[model samples]
Target: MSNKLFCEGRWTEAIAQYQKLLEIQLGDADIYYNLSYCYRQLNLLDEYFQALQQAIKLYPQEGKLHFSLIIDLRRNGRIQEAILNAENAAKCLPNDYTFKILKYLTVPSIYENQEEINFYRQRFIQGLQNLIQQTYLKTKEEQQSALAGIGRLTNFYLSYQAQNDIDLQRQYAKLVHEIMAANYPQWVVSLSMPKLQPNQKIRIGYASHYLHSYSGTLWLTGWLRYCDRQNFEIYCYYTGNEPDPVTQQFQNYSDIFHHIPYNLSAVCEQIIADKLHILVFPEIGMDAQTMQMAGLRLAPLQCVAWGHPVTTGLPTIDYFLSSELMEAENAQEHYSEKLIRLPNIGVSYPKPYIPPVVKTRSDFGLEDDAVIYLCCQAPSKYLPQYDFIFAEIACRLPEAKFVFLRGTLLEPRLKRAFAAVGLNSEDYCVLLNIPERLDYLMINLLSDVYLDTFTWSGGNTTLEAIACNLPIVTCPGEFMRGRHSDSFLKMLGVTDTIAENETEYIEIAVKLGLDLAWRRTIAERMSQNHDRLFDDKACVEGLESFYKEVCSKHFSA
Candidate 1:
């Protein structure tokens, strides 16, 4: 009965039955895995972790369990724990070098310096090359499984190190493609696209694991919201996400909605059968399943967008759909795929609605009169090199208090970095609980200025702040990932906050902190012009044209 419930995707009901079964048969490792899988589907992270531990203890040699645990660790930014497990997995699965590569792929969340980051990156690159060069006697199926395990999350941490990762990213992509080719040679060479039948709309497939409500994925929906459904038949492959309202909206938009969470081969076969004209990965490197799928040629023409904002180095990806504003003139060099710069900010992102809330600064334990700079990017993005910005800003404005989302593991690192510069971080920095969606908007509403991270800029967070009429102070960095706010501000025609150098960034921030009139002026400008960002039909129209053009070119006579 538990198995039946599980088969039907009734995760909650199945979990209850599994628990009862487990109470009687604690020795069954497979049952423990099922319980853990059910808990994970429900997003009960701690419960899932515990159940996985029990399952692994019962059967330590199982490759799937180890990979599952490692994937979970990688997802939660538990770098040290993931590395430890990768090391263990490498020891256990000596024949499969994927875990050994995975150990290097996961870097330190908080780097001590450039040298430390370089060390990890070099090792990761070397590991990928080694995998490509070495021989494995493992069967094609086993090799395919290993590739999926490693591809669960690509080298996402490397982008935060503020360097061009094209070589390294492409190297990994080459390795992934090599394995994929070995397993499925037919997909290695692109299949000719089927001709479009009379009265038929283009069959477009969009695949990703983040089709639900998440901040990182918010921009992805903009394309779908305004799509020309009459001209395009959208087929969405949701690769395992807890269904939310956002997921429901995607279902409403899709002609065919498929939720294939496990069984990589089955998903690939299903995609092949769909015979899509164009396949789009809204974001890759975030989900293992999506990453694994991107390595294969299920579609004649495949593309990736800046939803995750890093170039997917896979040779199978035909294009990188980006924005004219976000990418530099030479941006083509950054990606393996052909660069297609869409108009404005590219995606027709709807202006977020931040309802009027009367939450005062004191409600969040913030001083009512202090200059609250929301430095709320994940703790990992706050590099040691940029930690001085907080201290420098605080020195000029004594009442300056930077608000950061609480991260227990890496929060102390930021605090220590502040101490090294002779600043008492507690006085200048407030590590607070990450609030609910509306409350996060309220935090933006309450804050004086939005402090953008130097290397990795905020995407949706910047948009939300703009929606709140908040003034953003950003210094555009070297890469496209670092220039998100630069694009937003340029599109909004508010370039006053964009800084060219560290000195100017601090100066601009200081001026914003001191001059209330100036802040009010910038807020007024945003209020007048911010509406331009939302509900764009032009980008959608452009997307439709792109679809028709690509299909026309690829379709067989």
Candidate 2:
């Protein structure tokens, strides 16, 4: 009864049934697991943890109980406990298929910290080497199993190296493609969605995991608010566990708002049942839940936007929301999705909190005479080319220091990349435990110039830097990450700072460092031009007009 109730989406009743079962049998592990599932469904964090702990304690030898606990711990950002539980679970069911899956899920956290990443990378490499040695001694079936395990381990290690090493990403992508073709061929083709009527009101669906506090959601909120109500209906599909105050505000703008937790198939079916004409995937590869949803064709027109600038490489994704500034002459040829350009500076919305001015360099731990060069790019954006460029700038400016905000997963690799480029540890700093987004913005104000990363540009970071009256020097590259800074700089009327190549990039950095007057002039203008770059009203008008044009074409066809 509890399982049936849970499947039927009656989670509260499911919890009641589980509670009754637990009362009759105090040591029922399955009942405790069901209760934990129900609590997780209702976003009752404490109850979920308590129930999961009870389930694990009752069924200490069960792999599934430990797996569930590991998942919950990781989701709640309890990394240390998750790692320990994963290790224990691996020991409990050494040869089980579920154990392999649980181990895969837990391995990423081993690379969450700097020291852990290096340690795991070496451990994985050594394990693969040992497996190769054992293959010669084993039977054919055993050898094949060992090779498969090694393949999976290689993919995990490659994903960790992808940020700082492009060669590794390419090599891993090839290996994964080969392995999938040989092992799981069914995952290749794109899933098709329901057909749509031309005259019907276009039902646009927005999908995201961070529909709560993320900056990408801020842009999406404005787009939904300004949608043409007469011609279109907006549907929001959120995969997040908890809904914040902003998420509640976003709910008010949607025709239908549904939180389908962890059920990708049901979420896709729900959107298809509603006859959604357009499905917008705001986050591409960031969240597993969001990525799984994008793999299914939930609507007739599946689109991706600002959240992830990379090509999703999924055939189900039909279009990429882009702009002239970001999508260069050859972008359409490179990316898998059809390009749809927005009229203005791509997709951006105004942030609710504005940062206050910092009085001095002492505020953020910097010398008054130091020329602070800030790169607030997320750790994944720190490519080899970016390291080379920054090294050149540091070499040219002896008094300059580089500062970065470390991501939860990539801090160690980031520090290593900086060191590899001849930058001293003292010349770099990483700020931790920042309580709010506004605090991050205030720190940007203390910098002299904000340098944009290559390959992948800073999106929200660039906008926030401008908002804090910091001048940004960007050299636009090929894809989404490369072009974001270009679009924002153009929108803010500060295109002179954009460079073309290595020489120009270094020159631009030096100029920004040496010419204080020019830097101040650009910063002052950028501060005044925030209205044009982040105005919600203008963004809405442009989006609504584009929607009308697309609707007209669809109807006429």
Against the true structure, whose TM-score is highest? 1
TM-score of each: 0.86, 0.67
lDDT of 1 by residue, 1-557 (tens): 99999999999999989988877866477787888899998889899888877787778778778888887876666667887888788787776656756655667666766677778777766666775566352687567655655655566677777788888888877777777777767777777887778888888899887888876677777788778867888998887759898899888878899988766777788888999889999888777668778889999889998888888899999999888888888888888889988888888787887799778889899988999998778766777677677788887899898888755545566577678777787888787776577678778899999989888898888888999999999988877888899999988888999999999999999999999999999999989997677666777777778878887776634
The alpha-carbon RMSD values of the candidates against the true structure, listed in the order shown, are: 4.8, 9.9
Q: Lowest-lDDT window of 10 residues in candidate 2?
A: 151-160
For model 2, the stretches where C-alpha displacement exceeds 4 angstroms are 1-200, 358-360, 407-423, 427-433, 536-557
**Model 2 agreement with the true structure over 2-56: per-residue lDDT tens digits:** 8899889899999888788778877567777778878888889889888877777
- Candidate No. with top lDDT: 1
Off-target runs (Cα >4 Å) in candidate 1 are 1-85, 96-98, 135-138, 555-557
Model 1 steric clash pairs: 152-288
Give each model's whole-structure lDDT. Answer: 0.81, 0.66
TM-score of 1: 0.86
